[model samples]
Target: MGRAGHRTALMVAACAALLLAGCTGAQGTNGPELTNTSPVPVSPGSEADPTSSPSSGESDEDGDDEAGDDAPEPSASATETESGPAFPADTKPDTAEPTGEGETFLSVTDVRVAAHDGYDRVVFDLDGTGSGKPGWRVEYVDQATDDGSGDAVRVDGDAILRVSLSGTAIPTDSGVEEFSGDRIEPADTESIDEIVYRYWFEGYTTAFIGVDDAERPFRVFLLEDPMRVVVDVRH
Candidate 1:
C-alpha cells in the first residue's frame, strides 16, 4: 500500500508541473498582449498627402479676390444733358433776301409781341398771293422817319431800331387783310417800349421799334407756317 500511494503522488506532481509550464509560456512568448484601448480607424478621403499639388483658382498669399476690384469708376462727364437746338444770335444789323421766287406780294396781316425768358419777341404775320418770303433790313436809327413821305415819325423810347421790309404790297393789291394799327404797345414786355407801324407803299414797308435800352442786342429770323418775321430783343 505504501509504494503504490507514493507512485501515484509522483505522477500527479509531474502532471501539475507540466500544466504550470504551458500557462507561463503562453503568457510570455506565444501571443500578443491585449488591452482595453482599441486601434484607431482611418476616415475615407479625409486626409491629404503632404507632397500633393494645390488645387486650381486659389491664391497662394492673398485671400479670395473680388470681381472688378481694379476697374475704374464711371465719370460724371459721361452722363448726357438734355437741351434744345442752338439758336445763334447777335447784336449786329442783319439783312436777308427773299426766299423761293424773287417776286412776292406779302402784306402784314397781324402783329404779335410777347415777353420770354431772356428776351422780348416781336412777330409780324404776313399772308397774300406770294411765291416767296419777304426780305428785310434791320438797323438802329437816331430818329424814325416815314419811308414814303420823309416825314418825322414820333416814337417813344430811349432808342429806335428801324425795320424795313421789301417784296411787299398794299392790302388792296395783295387782296389780303392788313394790320390796321399805327402803334403797338404790349404788356409784360422786357425790352420793348412800343412799335410804330407804317403801311406798305410801293414794294416796301417800314416800321420802328422803340426799345427800353439803347443799342440792345437783337436777333432776327424768319419762320414759315403762315410766313412770319421774328425779332428777338435781349433784356
Candidate 2:
C-alpha cells in the first residue's frame, strides 16, 4: 500500500478501538447506562417520601402552634339556680317580742314585697338610733282600725291581718326618715291582696295586710344587721 493509504488505515483502526472500548464498558456494567441523567439529592438519614405527608415529629410540632387542641370544652349547665323556701302547712298567727330595750327608737325606712314559688314575702326595713331590735304582734282581725284616730280604715280582701310593730318611734324622735309611700299592691303575690301602712302613733307602728278569702298560714321573724321584719304568707 501507499504511504497516505497506510496513514489513513492506522487512524481508522485507532478510532474503531476507542469505539469498542466505550461500548464494552457500557454493556459490562450491571445496570443499563443512562445518558445526560441528573442524580437527585437525598438527606442523610431520612426514609419517608419528600412530597408525601410529614413525619410524626414534624406533625406534632405543627400541632403545637394551635392552642386548646386537646383541652375539654366547658359544660353548659355547670351552675345551678337558687330556689325559694317551701310552703307552710300551719294557718296560725305568729309574733315576736322586741330585743335589747323596752322602747326602741326605730323608724320604718322602707317596705318591700316579693312573691315566691309557694308564698309571698313582705319586708319592713327599719333604721334609727335604737338600742335593740323591734317587736311585732301579728294576728287576724275582723276589721282594721287606726290607733291615732279610732276611725275604721277601709281595706280590700275578705280577711284582714293586723301587723303591729312595737317599740317604734316617730320620725322626729328616731332621727331617721320614715316611709312616705302609702299603699302597696303586689302583682306577683298569690295570697296577699294589698298592704295599707299607717303612721307611727304612741310607740307603735300599725299596718294592715289584706288577704284573699280566708286567713292563710303566716310566719313573722326579725333580723339584725340593718334591722328588718319579715312576713311570709302562704298562697
Candidate 3:
C-alpha cells in the first residue's frame, strides 16, 4: 500500500471512533442508568418522590369514611302528655238559707262522704230545723288547726280544706259530745284524703277535708227539709 492510502485510512478510523464515543454518552433503548444526567420529566399520575404523601383527588360516592356507613342518624325532638278532667269549678262560700230556720238549735247528726264522677261530696245532716241560712266558709290551706284550741292539725295530703259551718252544734251530756267516729276519714273515699271533724266552738263547727292534689276545684251548697250542707270537691 502507498503512504497516502495509509494516512487516509488512519483519519477515517479516528473519525469512526469519535462518532461511536459520542453516541454512547446519550440515552438509548436500554433506558437510563444511575449515572444519567439528563432532566427526568414527571409523568402524569406517577409518584414524584417515593417517600412523599399522595395527592388529593375526587373520591367516589360509594367509598366509606373513617366512621363508616354503619353510623346511626341523629334523633328527633320529644313529645307531650294528655290534659285533666272536665267539670264545673266553683269554690265560693255561702250564707244560711231563708227557707228552713225555725228550730231553736241545729244539731249535727251525721257527717258523710261519697265519691262521684270527678268529685267527692261531703254531706252534713242536721236533726233540727234549717230555716236560718247555715253560714259556711270552705277553702284550701297549707295548715289545719283546731277551731277551739288553735292547735295545728296534722293533715296528710297535698292540701287541707278548712270547712267552717257557722250555725250547727252537737247535744251531748259532756258539754255537747260531738259525733263519734274517726275525726279523719279517707278509708272509703277517692279524691278525699281525709274527713276530719275538728271542733265545735261558739256556735261554729270547723272541720278539715284533706284532698289528694292542690289544684282541684270545689263548690258548696245547701239542701232543704233535712237541713244538709253539701260540699263538692273535684278530683
Candidate 4:
C-alpha cells in the first residue's frame, strides 16, 4: 500500500480485468442476455420490411406490365372488326328478253329472270301435256279475238279476265273459271298486265306474265295443238 500506492492498486486491478473481459465477449457473440426482462423487440428495419424488398420488386413489375398491356386491346379490337360486306362470290341473275309476235307455242326449258328492288320476275321451262284434250280454257273477250291484239282484255282490275283450268275440263264443280266481257274495259292494252296459270295434270302448261311497271315489256305465245295455247303479254 505504499509502493506508489501499491502501484496504483495494481493498475486498478488491471483495468477492471480488461473491462470484464469485454463484457463477456459481447454477451456471447450478440445473442441472449439483453435483460430488462427481455420482452421481444429487435426492430431494426423489422426484418427488412418483409423479404428483401425494393417495394416488393416494384409491385411485381407493375403487375406484369398491366397484364401485358391489357392483352393486345381485345385482340386488336377483334382484328379491326373483322372486315365486312362485299357480295359477288359467284353471282348470277339476269335473263328475260322476248316481247310478242307469234310462232313459239311451247318448247322452252329453264329460263330465269330476276330483277330485284322493285320486283321483276320471269321464269319458264315448259313442254308437254297438262291435261286431256280441251281440259283447260281461258277466255277474256270483250272484243280482241283474232287470237289477240284487238284490244279489250283486262285483269287485276277485275274487268273479268281470269281462268285456270287443269285436266279433264277442270270443273270439279268450280275451282277456277272466269271470263270477262263487260266489253273488256280497262284498256291501256299492255295486254292486261299480269297473268299466271300453271297447269299440271299430265305434263305441263305454264304461263306467267307479270308486269305492272318494271319498265313494261313482256310477250310469250306458243300455241297450235288442237288448241294448246300459252300467250302472255305485258307491256
In lDDT terms, which candidate is top? Answer: 2
Candidate 3 pairs with clashing backbones: 96-133, 96-134, 97-133, 100-130, 100-131, 101-130, 101-131, 101-132
When 1 and 3 are scored with lDDT, the better candidate is: 1
Backbone clashes, each candidate? 0, 0, 8, 7
**Once superposed on the true structure, which residue ranges of model 1 sit more than 4 Å away at CA?**
1-90, 100-103
lDDT of each: 0.77, 0.79, 0.66, 0.35
Looking at candidate 4, what is the lDDT of residue 73?
50
Error of 3 at 39 (Å): 99
Model 3, span 41-92: residue lDDT tens: 7766566744544445433344434344577875531110111233345544
lDDT of 1: 0.77
- Residues 1-235 of candidate 4 have per-residue lDDT tens digits of 5789999999999999999988887778664566586666455545545544334335463476356666755443211222222222221221223222132223332233333222232333233333223223333323222122333333343322323223222222223332211221223334344443333333223233333433233222223332223333232
lDDT of 1 by residue, 42-117 (tens): 5443345434433566443454343346668764321111112233454567798876444567899888788877
TM-score quality measure for candidate 2: 0.61
Deviating ranges (above 4 Å) for candidate 2 = 1-89
> Which residue pairs does candidate 2 place in steric collision?
none
TM-score for each predicted model, relative to the true structure:
0.61, 0.61, 0.54, 0.20
Ranking by TM-score: 2, 1, 3, 4
**Residue 205 displacement in candidate 3 (angstroms):** 0.7
